[model samples]
Each structure stands twice: as C-alpha cells, then as structure tokens.
Target chain A: MDSFVLPSFISPNSEDIKRRIYARIRSDLHRIEAEIDRNINSSIPLISVVARHIMGSGGKRLRPLLMILSSRLCGYTGDRDVSLSVVFEFIHAASLLHDDVVDHAEFRRNQPAANTIWGNPGVVLVGDFLYSKSFLMTVGYNNIRILEVLSSATTKMAEGEVLQMVHSDNLEVDEEEYLEVITRKTAVLISAACQVGAIFGGASPEEEEALRAYGHHLGIAFQLVDDTLDYTGDVKELGKPVGNDIREGKATLPLIYTIKKAKPSVKKRLGEIFCAEEILPENFLEVREMVMRSGGIEYTLHSAIEHVQKAKESLDIFPAHPTKETLVEIADYVLCRRV
Target chain B: MDSFVLPSFISPNSEDIKRRIYARIRSDLHRIEAEIDRNINSSIPLISVVARHIMGSGGKRLRPLLMILSSRLCGYTGDRDVSLSVVFEFIHAASLLHDDVVDHAEFRRNQPAANTIWGNPGVVLVGDFLYSKSFLMTVGYNNIRILEVLSSATTKMAEGEVLQMVHSDNLEVDEEEYLEVITRKTAVLISAACQVGAIFGGASPEEEEALRAYGHHLGIAFQLVDDTLDYTGDVKELGKPVGNDIREGKATLPLIYTIKKAKPSVKKRLGEIFCAEEILPENFLEVREMVMRSGGIEYTLHSAIEHVQKAKESLDIFPAHPTKETLVEIADYVLCRRV
Candidate 1:
C-alpha cells in the first residue's frame, strides 16, 4: 500500500482518492505501460533510449488514463483501447522532447532533458519518430474519426507551441492570449485523448461531447495548477526547479493574473525583471512574492477549481460506474497533485 | 521559353526533356502550387512566414511532381490528385525544416535556411505544424492504404535521420549502410509519394507495385546523383556549398567508395581529414580530388544511372502516354540535373 500524500487544502477524506483511482485503474495502467514499451521499440538505439528516458520517467500517465477511462465509460470492452491509449502518451512525450529542444531545457521530470543527453538533432528526429509511430498505430485502427481528432489536435498543439514561443518574454501578453496558448498547446491533446477514446468506444455524439468537455476543462485546470505549482511547489516534489516559468520568461496564468492585479510600482518592477537579459535570483523571488501577494496563486487555483467542477459536471451524463468515478477522482487529483 | 542546360555527358536530344516535361505538367504544377499555398494557410503568422521561406524557395518540387505524374500515368483524372500531391511536398518541406535545424545548415535553395531566419525553436515548431497539417490533410482522403504508406514512410524517414545522425562523423560507414540511410531518409518518402499517387489513381495491384518500384529506384538514383553533385557540381548552381557532405562528415556513396578503394597512404590522410574537428577548405578539396581520381564520382554516377534504368523500366507495363514518357524523361533528367 503506497502512502497517499495530500495537499494541505484538500480534505483528509480525499487522501485515499489517489489510492482508489490507482487501485481501480491499476490493470489499465499496467497495460498502458506495457504497450508504450512495446510500441517505442525501434531499430535505432538512440530513439529507443531517448524515448524511454522521457516516457519511462515518472510521468503521471494522466493523458493515457483519461483515454482509457473515457473509453471504458463509453462501454468500450475491446482490447484495442489499451494499445490505442498509448498514442496519446506518445504524442505527449514527443511534444515534450521537442519542447525540451525548443526551450533548451536542462531538466525534465527530475532528470536531464533528452536533448541534453542525445543532442538536439537526435532528440528532434526521435520526437518525429514517435509522432509517426503514433499515426502508424492509429492507421492500423482504420478509424478515420480517431485520426481526424488526433491529427487536428496535434496541429493545434504545434500552433500553440509556436504561439507560446511568439509570446515568450513579452510582458504584454494578456489573460485571453495566455488562455488561447494553453488551450491549443496543453488542453487540445488531452481533449483529443478523451474524444478519441470515446470515438473508439463507439460513443454517442452527446456522450462524446461530454467526455470532450470533461477533458477540455480538466486539461485547463491541470495546466493552471501546474503554473501555480511552478511558483509555490517544492523543487523536490515538483521534480523540477521552482520558478522555471519565470526563468524561461513564459507568461503563464499566474504571472498574467499577477500582472493584471499588480500596483503601478510592482508592475514596473515586473516589467524590468522580465525584460532584463538575465533575471537575477532576487528578482525571481520578488516576482513570486508579488504574485502571491496579489492573490495570483489563489486566483489561478480558484480558476482551476472552477474548471475541475465543470469537468466533473461534464461527466454527469454517465451513470454510476467505477471508471467514471475514477475519472472524477482524477480530476480532483489534477488540482491536488504536487508534481 | 526557359532555356535548358544539359550536363556535359547528356545527348543534345535530352536537353529538351526538361522543357517537354514541364510543358506537359505545367498546369498540374500550377495546381499543386496553389493547393500547397491553400493548405499551408495558417492562423499563426510565424508558421506562414517560415513555411513560405522554405516552400517558396527554388525547390524542384520533385516529390510532388512524381506524385502528380504517377497519378496521371495511372489514368486518374480527378481533382484530388493536385491537392494530394501537395501532401508530399508538405511532408518533404517539413523534413527539410527539421533537417535544417538538425544539420545546422546555413543555406537551402540559395537562401538562408529557415532556422537561421526564425531561430530553431520556431523552425522546429513550424515543422511540427506542417507535419500535423500534412497528416490532417491526408486524413481527409479517407484512404487507409495511403495513410499506411505515408505514415510508415515518415516513420522510416525519422529512423533514417537518426541512423544518419548515429553514423555522422563516423568514417567506418560502408556502402550498404549508406544505401540504407538514403533509402530511409530520401527514397522512402518519394516511393510513398508515387505509391500514394497510384493508389489515388486506382491502379491495379501490379501497376501500383510497378510505380512504387519506379519511385524507389528514382529516389535512390536522385540521391546518388545528389551525393555526386556534392563533390563535383558548381556551388552556385547547387544553391549550397560544394563539399558540404564531407564538411558535415556525412559519408555518402562517393566518399564511402573512395575510402574503400584508396591506397593505404590516401586512406590515412582521408581518416585524418574526416576525424579532424573542422574540415579545412584545402582538406575538402583534397578529399574531392581523391574521390575523383579514385573514380568515386564515376562509380556513384554509374550506380545512379543503373537505378535510373530500373526506374524507367518499371513503367514499361504502362502504355506510352505523355505522363509515362515524362516520368521516363524525368528519370533521365535526374542523372543529368546539376543541382
């Protein structure tokens, strides 16, 4: 029995939420792990090595879990779900590999980024390999709808990443623009995972829309909490350094909210720190303090909680089932997870 | 009335081959260009900018032309061929964009590589966008076999790139290994283009296989000639530096063959030059001279010509139509093209 660690704000009863969800989905998670390992096998040793480094690292498998649970909720009893669920994970990992190169990131998931180890060229190619592999697997399914969802989602994800790059280090980025970027970059793929799962499960149109909505809100909430944790979470728990967004000049929700609410002097200081060639450690701390003082963290959390509620509400159409229950719990876990 | 320049060895009758092929496919090429522009239209301005920077450059459009021509040869008169043909170009351009970053290439088609203009991050993301867009467009076709061929080809292309990266700067790469690399990195996509075109044209299985064979050999021949041109062609005509392969330490067939046949003294010098941190201009020239003297250029060109014969022979089953004749001529021009 693994110990369940709860965030301070969560009720004590919610501590077992992780345990319950994991217990219910343990078999599915194992299948997903096996499928990922099997699918990522390649003739090129570097591709397999880099792919394993990122995919086998301590990823929560949140996207694949959403996919599997959504499929099950829609009454998909076929064995294909297990294999297909890995597609989302592969796409997610591919984007991360590319993101590592794009951001020149040093660490990811508590270890050196694959680009640092394998070099950017190999990493980029491996990411392409994983992407092509995902599509190849989807092609085997012979379901055009699933391909449509996955491909469009990936297109949006790329556009989102480019949008984020365009907005990087620009203090003028507003809340709407930030939301658009996050929606395309982070939420679209998660939503696609659920929607594709629903499609594979032969879901009704309404049910598919519900699951899609559930994933959309949950993805936003997940990213909002992630942004908040970047400032507030422990480096050890987060498995990456705190204040990375500020360091990288990414204008996430917390920073956008803080900038919106900051006083004139604080806003000026924030502008200076963000615009400077290098952000000093003291400046990072000052920005974090300002964000917290201005209720940016609380505001982001509040927004996340709202989205989580909407996500759960989106699942109301599905009747009582262990899969749906676990999915609901997963939504709450999105907010409570430290990493 | 563009004048055609023939390589010194080509008969004067073949000088008109390029003009004849272009005159035959001019409308199809125009349609392909327009379709590409339409398909590549993106909401993200940076994507459009970077994509145009590469796609609008003086690319020969060889892959798309093969697809269009192959489809025509198969007797498909539908409008979809024009749109579908652009898919090949989009995928090719996407790979090149990523390759620019991967190779740190300074020039492509006589202009600065897109990475140098927009930076690597944007280039990588735009490449991702183009890839996704290509997949999304293919999904609209509702053809599983086409998807299978393309997805598998892209998978191999990525593997090929990683294999090439693994072999980069390694002097021990032999002829067979070089062939494997080029087949995956270059031939696979081109083969896929022709195969997909045949599929779209509703070719019989034998005819489909023949076109696939045609494309496979033509792609190999195309790459072989490219490798030879790297050693022998004028830099301005090539639109990139001469000896780039050697400078990048890429062991193409010419280099590999030279290494195999060189005397011990020349072999020792070749090793020293290839192993050096940076290849000097004089070292590049010396290596080129050695390749020529050892008949490396001749051997590679001879091999390319053999493949071109095979490519042309693959179309023997088809009745002599303008499209088939042009494809044959295109095979001849592949050997004769200096760029």
Candidate 2:
C-alpha cells in the first residue's frame, strides 16, 4: 500500500512522455502482442472467441505499456526489446486467465470472464496455450538469464496462486501473506519487464536493479489500489461490482481491518457470509457499511497511497528523464484514478 | 492399432529387442524421473508433493524406452536423445494430470488420480510445473529445433485436450476425428521423441522422416490397442475398469467401429451410453459383447495392426543394427503389453 498512492502525492511535470522513444515503444509493444497472437493455439475456437472478447474490450494494456516505456526510459533501441515486451503482456494475460479460474470469476473489467462463458476447461486450456507461447517466445532471444528470470517469475506466479487458494475462505489471512501473493502473482512480471528492458537496453547492473525495484513497487501499488477500489470506489467507474473481494471470500485489506475491529457477533456474522461462494446484496451491503463504520476502507486506501509513494521513491535512483517522469505519472494514476 | 501391435507380433525377433532395451530404458527412465523429482517446482514442498504423487505411483516407463531404442536404431547414440526420452515421459505425465481433471478420473494405475487426491487446482498447477521444467530442460540443450519440436508438440497436446472436451459425450465422433485427437494429444509426443532423437542423433532427412513415421504410426497403433484393451483387458492387469472409455462417453476404436455396424436400436443404445460419465460393470460387459458381435472391436484391432506394420516397414531404412533390433522388439512388446 505504501507504493500505491505515493506517486500521485509526489507529483510529476510530464503529461505523457511524448518522445520518439515513447512512440517507438508503443509500436514495439504492438508488434510483440501481434507475434504472440500468432503463436497462441489456433485450434481452440474458444480461445479465439475469448481472446477477441477480451482484447477487443479495450483494455488499458498497462503491462505492455510498462515494459515498453521502461525499456525506452533505459534507452533500449532494438526491435528485439519489442518482442520481449509482448512476452511480458502474454505473461500478464496468462496470469489473469488463471486468476479468474481461481477466483471463479464471472466478470472482468465490466465484461464476462472467458471461463464464465466458455467453462473452466476452455479457460484453463487457453491459459496453457498462452503459457506455452510465452515459453516458446523466450526461445527466440537465446538469452539464458532472461529465460531464467521469466520462467522463475511464472513459477512464482503459480505458487502465489496456490498460496492464495490455501487462504481462500480463511478470514484470518494477514496483510503479510496477501502482500506476498500479489508480489509473486503480480509484481514479478512488472519487475521483470523493467529488468529485461534494462538488460536489453544495455543498462548496468545497478540501473537494472533500480528499474526492477521500481516496476515491482509499481505492480504492488497497482494491485493494492485495485483491492482498495473493489471496496470503496464506484462500481460504474471501476467497471465491476463494489465490494467484490468479500464475495470471493478473499480477505482483502478492508475486510481484514473490519474483522479486526468488529464486535464478536458482527465478526461471526461476517465470517459466515464471506465464507460462502455466493453473497446476497443485502448481506453485502451490511458488510460494506460495517467496514466503512469500522474505518477499514479508509485505512486500506491510505495503505494503497503509501504503496504508490514507495513506487515513486524507487525511481529516485533513475536520472530525471521523460521516461522516468512518465513512470512516475503511471504510479500516480494507479493510486489516484477513480476507476 | 496396426502400427502399435504388429511391430510386437510380427517382428522376426521382437522379443530380443524388448529384452535388451527394457532394463536399460527402465534405468534411464528412473534417472530422468529422478530429475523431475529433483527439479519440478522451485517451491520445494510442492516439488516434494509432486515427487510423492508421481514417483510414488508404480508404473512402467515405456515411452522413454521407445525414444532411446528408436534413436539407437537410427544409427546414433547420444546422451541428449535419452535425456529427451525422459522429457517425453514427463510430458506424458504432465498431460495425464490435466487429462484427469478433464476426465474427472478417479483411479489411475491402481492409485488415486492426482486431481481426486490433491484436488483439481493442485493437479493443474503441478502439471504446469512439469511443463515449465520440461521447457527449461529443452532450452538447456540450446537446440532450437528440438525446442520447437517439443513446444509444437506440447501445443498440439493441449489442443487435442480441448478438441476432446468439445467432442465429449458425443457418440457421433468419427474415426477420422478420433484419430486426429489422439494423434495430436497422445501420438504427437511419442512421434516427437523419436523425431527429436533422430535429429539429435544426426540422422539424415530421409532417415529422420522414416523414424518419424515409425513414431507416428507406432503411437497411433499403441493408442488403438490400448483402447481395445480398455474393453477387453482384465481389471487386475489394467488397473482401471475395463470399458472405461465407453463409460466416459469416449467413442474409442471398438465402440466407434461397432456403432457403425449396430442395428438402429443398438446404435441408439450406444448414443445413450456414450452420454455417461460412468457406466456400471453390467453395462460395460453388455457393450463389449455387443461391440464384438457387431465386429466393431475386430475391425479396430485390424486397423491397429495395419499401423504397426507400417511402423515396422518404416524401420527398413535403418538396416539391422542392434538398436534396430531392439526397436523391433519394442514394436512387438507394445502389441502384447496388458498394463
């Protein structure tokens, strides 16, 4: 949460880092996604169906953007970096697929989940397809170290998913464990995108480390803010239901804080409601008010802001450049955005 | 079924080849599975769990033997071929995990299916762990061609699963589609192991093609014979129930063939039976007799034998090397194996 809101409060002068490098990065990310699209299994009509469903849904394409922007910030000047950027996005998409399966989610970004429409097996297979394609894409670079970084990231993501699974329906899940899950399942890719970009851009070890930390912090901030929004933000703007975390039995920060502060009877009532796969709107509303009255939601938002701040602080080592400014702007947007 | 069975039955000296390769391949398979046990997931406990589940299960490692023996027959002996021989088995095992989830299978090789024991998500993630480990091993060879071969094979296997899912509970699945599904889902890796072995062993293009044909034909034959056995084999030997395919509504060779020859009512009975997830022993026996009476089982076996013959004929290009002799023995053994 330290990383989530820190960037916005810190402030940046640049609007969008409008440079040739930025344009090139955008072009490169596009190419990488196109290449990955080529490699995904052409057989599963369901895959194509769901992919079209999601890709055409006008996503922010944030991960690919981060990878390309970070690469450019480090002065990466090759077409290969573009290919690597695509790999990063594919990794993110793969995680999202598995996450929905784990979450048994019915929706994503205000739209239907692939699994909800196609069933779990199709979602699982398409996720597998994306994973295989990403691994194959890594084969093109011939960089063993890079492969290790990405493979290890993926392995960690799966582990994080398992960890989260163990925590499911357990209201006692702490902030430390939740943080760890997001770090592996989310932040690793962001960190890896930056690290790979720096490596490809010819950054030194220290610079690479700095950028990796920045991306990792950004990813943590991003997810924390996302979690916060699920409880406090407007559903119309967030493009999903409000207070969704409780529905999944996920011990999101707001709920955890509410549990910690609630009366014994209230806590017991909350537990019974949150532990189920389904939650009625009436119980959901009651829980929302309890969390708010207990100061849980505000506390979560503050923590999210802190995460954004940490994200900004990580960029202190990087020199003042437009790329750096844009990175800072992304962090600010992450925490402050109503959506 | 032809290629799978005839090699074992009609090979002039089939027994000799099986005898020589059996012990050696078994040792090598253990070594490779040892690597799988050692290097599965970085999450140590999960790796141990996978080891416990997979290595703990008692079963024959026949695929690796085919790879090693087939490669040796192609007039080349190298360590990578054998290492990759293990990779083939690992792929098979990993696919088994996902297959169980899709099939909702309970028993495998006389033990609980991983999904049934550890649950679906555990089986899925561990399957993924093995897959990533396999890719890592492939990349270690720095053999791009081999990586491509195995990668493409893996993709096909996933696709085949989806195809099977789409076709599930549908008795209308034809031999052509079933052939496509199994060839990709099961046979491709078997064929890939042989193809990769030939390539790694420095077989010429023609020889490589011949060996590839050997693997392809043999793989299809093997699946067909196994399907036949699913209808006819003894429970004590086969581990799982006989006619498990029909129970799962999978129109394997015998049922697929027999459906064609059955009276309209008989065919209708099959359609109903094929819609089930499990069938009682009484129904299984009734279907078996009905299939045999319709000559469905016999025709499928005949086709299987034709495949085995073609697989053997492909080996004519390899001359009469000892490895070639073992390959012949393997062909014969594959035809007769019960479990």
- TM-score of the second chain in each model? 0.96, 0.89
Stretch of 10 with least lDDT, candidate 1 chain A: A1-10
Query: What is the C-alpha lDDT profile of model 1 across A1-339, one tens digit per residue?
Result: 112233366555545777877888888888989988898788788888989998999788889888988998999987888888899999999999999999899998789888888889988999999999999999999999999999999999999999999999998899889889989989999999999889888899999999999999999998998898888877876778887888888988888998888888889989999888898778878888888788888788888989999999999999999888888899988887767
Stretches off by above 4 angstroms in model 1 are A1-14, B1-9, B12-14
Model 2 lDDT, residue A281, Cα: 84
The sequence of per-residue lDDT tens digits that candidate 1 reaches over residues B131-205 is 999999999999999999999999999999999999999989999999999999999999999999999999999
Show pairs that collide, candidate 1: none
- Can you give the lDDT of residue A122 in candidate 2? 74
DockQ of each: 0.90, 0.39
- RMSD, every candidate, angstroms: 2.9, 4.9
Q: State the lDDT at A168 in candidate 1.
A: 91
Which parts of model 2 are misplaced by more than 4 Å? Answer: A1-44, A74-84, A141-143, A199-207, A254-321, B1-21, B40-47, B66-86, B198-211, B261-269, B272-283, B313-321
